[model samples]
Target: MKMTKTPIKVRYQETDQMGVVYHANYLVWFEIGRTAFIESLGFNYHDMEQEGIVSPVIDAHMYFKQPIRYGQDAFVKTWIEEYDGLRTTYGYKIEDGEGNAAVTGSTKHVIVKKESFRPVSLRRVFPDWHQAYSDAYKSEE
Candidate 1:
């Protein structure tokens, strides 16, 4: 699939007394990776929100492999793991400066109406975006 790699520097404030990056910070990095992936596809989440469409995470899974210390540079590789009309799963890998994976995870989200929070199909709201995801997934095969 189409993947986007984003470089991030671990800030001291994101760590605990032991200097290891907090587990919760990985979720934040996942969000950053997801946003960058969408933007890479020429889509702006801000515009989607303004249009009354919101994508919220419905499920998440993370596997920690290595500990990342503060002040180290890392990279998050993100891609569309799967996408149906109503839901999309984004996969991520956080790698340390040496390219060792620190964590791997996936988040599943569904697009909904901001007012009612009713689930909506991305294909109905954004056909091009939906098609782009399909194309990327197929290309991987």
Candidate 2:
């Protein structure tokens, strides 16, 4: 499976008095990774929103493997773990400078109408995007 790695510089504001990154910050990293993944495919979220389509996260999960400290360089690795016609699950891993995973996560999202918040199928609204996601998806096998 191909994963896009986005480099991140840990900032003091993202950490606590203990110098360790706050747990919630990992979610932000996940988002950054997700955006990078989408951009890598030549698509941007702003264009989608302008087109009346938006994807909202329905589920989120994270596993902390190790502590990340302020001033450390980290990388977020992202990939399409699964993609169906209506939903997409993205996998994420945050690695420290030494390439050790500091956190692992996944987020599930569904496409929706930006105005009404009504669920929309990617297959119906964006066939090319759907096909691209399908092609990038990694199956359990």
Candidate 3:
């Protein structure tokens, strides 16, 4: 499986009074990683948005391994976990300076029409995008 890594600098504002990174920040990092992953596959999310199609997260989950403080080197590794035209699941791993996993998460999303927010089969809506996802699809063996 191919994974895309995106480096994220921990910012002071992203921390709480304890100086630990806020939990929500991991989700943001996941977004960054997911975007990079899509681009790495030669897909443009903005173009999809322009075409009145959007993929919205239906579920999100995270497992925190440790707290990350400001000024630490961190990066998110992302890969396509599963895709079956109707829904796509992306897996994420956030690592700290020493290459230890700080957080692991997954987000599931489904393509929908921007106007009505109605679900649409990716294969029926954007065949090329669907095929690309299928070509890179991954799942536990």
Best by TM-score: 1
What is the RMSD, in Å, between candidate 1 and the native fold over all Cα? 1.1
- Pairs that collide in candidate 3 are none
Clashes of each: 0, 0, 0
Note the residue pairs that clash in candidate 1.
none
Model 2 C-alpha lDDT per residue in residues 29-139, reported as the tens digit of each score = 999999999988888899889999889999999999999999888999999888879989999999999999999999999999989999988998888888778777743
Per-residue alpha-carbon lDDT of model 1 for 57-134, expressed as tens digits?
A: 999999999999998889999998988878899999999999999999999999999999999888989898898888
> Sorted by TM-score, highest first, which candidate order results?
1, 2, 3
lDDT (Cα, tens digit) per residue for candidate 3, span 54-74:
999999999999988998999
lDDT of each: 0.92, 0.91, 0.91
TM-score of each: 0.97, 0.95, 0.94
For model 3, the stretches where C-alpha displacement exceeds 4 angstroms are 138-141
* Greater-lDDT candidate between 1 and 2: 1
RMSD of each: 1.1, 1.9, 2.0
Off by over 4 Å in 2: 138-141
